[model samples]
Target: MNLDTPIEYLKGVGQQKAELLKKELGVYTFNDLLQHFPFRYVDRTRFYKIREVSADMPSVQVIGRVLSKEIIGEKQSRRLVAQLKDDTGVLELVWFQGIRWADKLVQPGAVFIVFGKPTEFNGRFSISHPELELYNPSAVKQGNLTLQPVYNSTEKLKQSFLDTKSLQRLQASALEIVGRSIQETIPDYLRSKHRLLNKADAIQQIHFPQNPNSLEAARHRLKFEELFFIQLKLLRNKLLRTGKFRGLLFGQVGEKFNAFYSDKLPFDLTNAQKKVLKEIRQDTQKGIQMNRLLQGDVGSGKTVVALMSMLLAIDNGFQTCMMAPTEILAKQHYASLEKMMGQGFINMALLCGSTPKKERRIIHQALQDGSLNILVGTHALIEDEVQFKNLGLAVIDEQHRFGVEQRAKLWRKNSVPPHVLVMTATPIPRTLAMTLYGDLDISVINELPAGRKPIKTIHLFESQRLRMFGFMRQEIAKGRQVYIVYPLIKESEKLDLLYLEAGIEAISREFPLPQYRISIVHGKLKAADKDFEMQRFVKGETQIMVATTVIEVGVNVPNASVMIIENAERFGLSQLHQLRGRVGRGAEQSYCVLMSGNKLSREARIRLQTMVKTNDGFEISETDLQLRGPGNIEGTQQSGVLDLKLADLAHDQHILQEARDAVIRIFEDDPELNTDKNVLLKEYFLRKTPAISWNKIS
Candidate 1:
């Protein structure tokens, strides 16, 4: 059978087993089965004695003879228990689910080899459902048990008799069909230059390695292949877009930009900000659409850069639109920009779900008449009824929150799509950015604005609430506000309200309402009510704001000097970093108090320590990447950019770099993969094209 043969047609995997393979592992064809590489390999060369086995050990192998076998318990709970003895001690082997099947393979006097995890219960050691194989002296003499590959299997698959061992057997049978038949996908010259293993040998060694060195080589080759293809795909799209789409040229920075930069500038732009602005100017100057991703730490003046870019568009007689994910953030941006612009000739408007009908009519008239130079709003900006007259640039804040289709809708607003500048406060790790946003040009605002004091982070236990409250009082006495953020309890809103009530009560008892005006906000509150509470805090009507993570994204309170994160351990490092960012926006010295429980996990401790140590968002991001893999990062898994099987973004940075460089060389030499050397590459890419272009979404 060929590689394209259905898996059910294979030797060991019949229709029933094939369904299990497809359902559990997503393996459909013979080739798909072959590519399902083992997660780990075990050495069967050495056998451990029963006395040497421990609870902390991974799966271990031991040569033993079954001393006694018994069927214990009644129906439904019935199990087959066998007492196995090596040289030193006796070990109990129990099978809970497959007692009938296991009772056949193992017997009282049979000499067998057992492999499984060991656990101690009630002062006795037992191995539940150990893999037992008949022991043959000649098999050890022939070195047949040197290495064993273990495939991941689901419990359902195991119930259907397709366990890990069954999967391995099926894989071996599929490999036999694929033996020496696999053709090299990469060009021979590139393989030679990179010292990569051939596709056939790599596949074989990956599944059943003859030696550890071969296994490592196979891993390197496979990882390189996976990353190389991803880079190639992203780079190819970038090239195609640049070649095909001509951007509306903002020829020069004119009146509006010059006026904003020279006359109405709020603060001097940091060098980091200046550099990013320069890069953006260069992109807009070129006659190509700019799909640039601007990454910066919270409070790194990203909104300022965005404003300057919008002004650039306005200077060239075109309108700009900024879309935020939420109405609160949209209003915040509109307010901040309005305050910054300060009654200029340039007109700006805010369009959100809550915008008054009169204001919406005015915005629509101004937009249609080309009088509105800039519009900032939420998803309402992309509504069919709201259209732009001369939309030249679109700036998306927290770009990950929008889907590809939503962004595409914005692109269609203009015949030639406007220059798209997507900004994020969450600092993406360099490697992750390369894979996730490789198609988009990236600019990082790495420095905080000058004169901004680094927020001092402190970790305190629940017992230290009194001290935290005292510190809050001191900060409030300085005429500054404090934000107390609580984690959301999704299990029950009643329980959540109880937690919020308890916190509010404690704060009221400590800093009473008449003495301290405290506002409460959460997701449970209605939109208008939430806004009312938030406005009170922002307007400085309240001395303290007790809220949930709803305030994490776009709340800007310059007067707020302290952020007290209750149960900080429940928050991710990135979330903690974002909450910490809320307070340090002002020029005054700020503090972030991370209150957690007495007991902390190793990861939790690292997160707290990292927060307390530095204010670098990139550093915090890297630590976060390590602590909670790429999948758990905000919106990344949903983006499908990190849908990797084997090559880990956390650990394979070097491989990724190498693969990216290789892609660059390939494109530089042959942009269209038209050469004979790259025909295989083109075919492979065509065969594996994803159903959705995930990168375009972000």
Candidate 2:
């Protein structure tokens, strides 16, 4: 048998089982089934007497004879119950969901082995929906108990009689045929050096381990293999792209850049900003394609560094463009650049979807005529007609918000493609960044600018509303603006909007009219109306911006000192971090008030406590990863690069780092893997490389 043999042909996996496996688990061939490792394992050697079972025990295994079996309850609520007894005492075993098939397996006077968590009700112990099998002395060994693999299954699969035991049996059957035929995927020398098991042995032991030591060895081998391949693929693509693509060399800091540094600069560049610029300068001058990810916290000076980099491109006689996820943000960037650079000195224009046809026509003409030195806009900047004469640099803000195809369209604006600088305010953990954007060079501005105070975050219960309002009044009395944000639940936007509107009404009644102005924004508003409401907040016409999370990203008001997030427990750690970020942009002390209900879950309490503990985005991000897992972390989930099976980003950082280092060493010795020693590694990646569009990663 071969790895590619159809799973349907495997013993015990008939057509129906094969179809179910393929639909529920994505298993198509023997190779896929072999790779479907168990999520957890249960110890089978130790069996407990009925009296030993306690409610506090996690899961217990007991072997007992069935004393009585009967069906209880009426239709729909019907269930099967059996009284099981051992030498110590009697225990109740019950099944609520699957009755017919369960009735057949359970019979009076029959011996059985069962495993499940024990629960106490009415001074008696019982196990519900426990896994059971007919007790056979021949199947039991004389030595210590061994671990049994447990596979994840869906309700449909369980209803169809394909439980974890059935899956384990099917895997064992498939292994019997292909164990001898399987070949080593990793090289012999490297496997020996790393003390890893061979591919076949690891696969066998992972499914059915004989001991704890073998299971650990099997896990190490599989995790190492999984991570090593991912790192190798990422590094190989990076090397290939560097060799294939040539960039516009900005060889000198010409007049434009120099003038901007000396004349147009607002403040002294922070050490972090200076270091990032040096890295960008080096990449631009090297004449290799520059795809860099710039990460910073909320008040960090990323905008200035991006603007200065654009000046380097302009100094080299090439035009530049910046794209933001929202039109409000695009407009903000356009305005900030215009104010800082002076209008006529560098011809810049905004080309969002809201731009008028007449102005767009003029901007289009100037872009073709090589007069528009810089352009800032939303996705509208990538339109077919929006062409640049000499696009040398393209800076994307909140880069994860745009899809790979959308960003790829910007790259195609020029024949050779411009050097890309993708920036994000949501700080990515180092391990996540290396895996998600591993092909791109990463530069992090870890320090906030001088004189900016860290946002002081506090968690308050809803019962403290009067005190919260008093604090808001005090901040407003100090001539600082406030933001009151509400969450939008998916079940009902109208209900959420009603809550937001009610918040506005309550705030207006408290602050009362002539002395205060309130502006609201939400997803239901039209684009123009939303922009107008945002403008009112920016212009200080409104002392308070009462809105939903619509104001999460782009609204930047330096005068805004307080952000009160109502029902903050409903927000994720990342979103809560982002909302906290909205406040601390200005130089003066700012505060983030996380208003949650008193009855918060443990996870929600941790999120709020994390927020209250640190203002560092990276720290909050790591906590968020721990609390929510990598799949829920915003960009990594959608990137399709984090589909890890055995290697976890949170727990297995050491393995990931080792994998990356090994790839570097391998490539340093054999760049193309053309040597005889590395031929197996080359063939392995080639065989496993899926049709992934790596270009959109930037």
Give one clash count per candidate, in the order shown. 0, 1
Candidate 2 residues 1-698, lDDT tens each?
78899899998887998899899999999989988889999876688888888999878899899999899998988999999999999999999988988898898989888888999999899999998878877874532367989899888788888899888988898899888888788998889888999989999999999888999999999999988988888887788778778888988898988998999888788999999999999999988889999999876889999999999999998999999998878988888888778868788999998888999999999999899999999999999999899999999999998988999999899987799999999999888888888889999998988888889988889889899999999999999999999885233644333267678778989988899889889899989799889899899998999889888787789999999999888899889888888887778899999998778889999999999999889998898888777778987777877788887888888888988998899989888888888899877776776454333222
Superposed Cα deviation of residue 414, candidate 2 (Å) = 2.6
Question: Clashing residue pairs, candidate 1?
Answer: none
TM-score of 1: 0.91
Overall lDDT per candidate, in order of appearance: 0.88, 0.88
Q: Candidate 2 vs. truth: CA RMSD?
A: 3.5
Segments in model 2 whose C-alpha atoms lie over 4 Å from true places: 48-52, 63-114, 128-144, 489-498, 690-698
Candidate 1 lDDT tens digits, 1-698: 88989999998778998887898889999998888888988776678888998898877788889999999989888889999998799999999998879988888889988888899988778999987778887762622455678888889888988887887888788888776788788889889988999999999988889888888899999989988988988888888778778898999989888988898888999999999999999999889999999999989999999999999998888899999999889999998899888976578888999899998999999999999989999999899988888899999999988997898889988888899999999999999999988999999999889889999999999888789988998999999999998886233545322266678878889998588899999999999899899999999999999988999987999999999998898889999999999998888999999999888889999999999999999999999998888899887977876777779888899999999999999999998888999888988887788553423422
lDDT of 2 at 79: 91
